[model samples]
Target: MLYAILAYHVEDEILSWSPEQDAAVVAKVIEVQAPMRASGLLGPAARLDETRKARTLRGPGAGMVLDGPFSETKEQLLGFHLVDCATDDEAVAAARKLRAVNPSAVYEIRPVKLYVPADGFGTTRG
Candidate 1:
């Protein structure tokens, strides 16, 4: 099964980190991911740009373009990791590893409903 580990953190708290602190955190993240990557369980992962750079679009159809994220909250979606695991426990373990490195952040683990493309290229969730 595939799982999405969504990371949430306060933008201000992250921004307050010094350059060395940021580097240390990133190094720890890489260290924690090493085993998962070696096991071929880790997939796409990335840290999102600050929320200030985000643009939200709302309304009907394509929707009216907005200036920022759709919702306001103390914590923002900061990053995500896509992992393939054999069981829920395995996925949760991956989340735990991530949380250990980013102690101040929260992680939401969700099973993925993968989109498979057909001959015509339409998406079907599986």
Candidate 2:
């Protein structure tokens, strides 16, 4: 199964962490990724640009492409990791290792829902 490990910022994350501190965390991320890769668990990982670069589209017909940064929030998502694990224990272990690398960070580990192809009758079948 696939697990997504989400890391979001907390009160102290942006306020207290300096560039150097952030860099150290990034370095640890690198180390962790190496092990994850060796174990054949890591799928993809990325750090998003500030929310200022975001654009939201409500629907296809509106031609309404909203622009600009999202309203600021305290717990902005920082990044995530996608891991393929055989069991919950393995997924938790990976998340714990990441948490240990950066104690100040918070994470949410969740299972990825498997997608089923839609049946011809306009509905999805299991």
Candidate 3:
């Protein structure tokens, strides 16, 4: 199964870190991800920019385009990791490893739901 591990942290607190501090934290993240990558369980992952650079759109159709993130929370989604795990336990274990490196951050793991085509046609199976 495919799982998405969402990383959340206080944007202000992170931005306040010195360059050296930031680099050290990122280095630890890389170290934790290395084994997962070698195991072929890691997929696409990336760190997002601050909410100030984000744009939110809501309402009907294209809706109204707004500045910043949709939510007004101190904690923001900082990044995500896509992993292929055999069970929920395995996915949780991956999240645990990440937490070990950065205890201040929060990780939310969710299973991915893949769409399957039916009868070799364009129809999709729910």
Candidate 4:
């Protein structure tokens, strides 16, 4: 089986929708994600808080993790989805559905590469 990673560099801030509209969007997501999860097609999906809630680590010798998000670009990785799919077309279709709800935001779809050793030791290469 092949899987795709749905990643994105989001704007520094996201616009807020009205309570009623937010409820409706949540309802729609529930309908879609439920079916995909039932079929084992939705491997994983998540939403992250703003960059302000982030912490960064430099290196093994960098000591304690640093506070605050990047002070750099307006783009920050906001969230992602790992999907089990049959082909790139199917992945793109899924991405399109997500984009429909977040038209103003950007979305990216890429293949996920997993390495499983012949001995089946269950170690990840990347």
Give the best candidate by TM-score: 1
lDDT of 1: 0.89
lDDT of 3 by residue, 1-126 (tens): 999999999889999999999999999999999999999999777899887899888889879988968667668998999999999999999999999999989998999887242454533653
Candidate 4, residue 114: Cα displacement in angstroms equals 4.4
lDDT of 2 by residue, 1-126 (tens): 998888777645555779898899889988988988888889777776665567777767776778844647666667888889999889889988988888876788899896343356433553
RMSD of each: 6.0, 8.7, 7.3, 6.6
Name the lDDT value of residue 55 in candidate 1. Answer: 91
* TM-score of structure candidate 2: 0.72
Runs off by more than 4 Å, candidate 2: 60-63, 67-73, 114-126
lDDT of each: 0.89, 0.77, 0.89, 0.66
Two-way lDDT contest, 1 vs 4, winner: 1
Better of 2 and 3 by TM-score: 3
**Which is the better candidate, 1 or 4, if ranked by TM-score?**
1
Worst 10 residues of 3 by lDDT: 115-124
Q: Estimate each model's TM-score.
A: 0.86, 0.72, 0.85, 0.66
The candidates, ranked best first by lDDT, are 3, 1, 2, 4
What lDDT tens digits, residue by residue, belong to model 1 across residues 1-126?
899999999889999999999999999999999989999989777899999899987899989887888556799998999999999998999999999988999898999998342464424642
**Alpha carbon deviation, residue 62, candidate 3 (Å):** 2.7
**Model 2: pairs clashing at backbone N, Cα or C within 3 Å:** none
Error of 4 at 49 (Å): 1.4
Instruction: Give the CA lDDT, 0 to 100, for residue 49 in model 4.
Output: 69
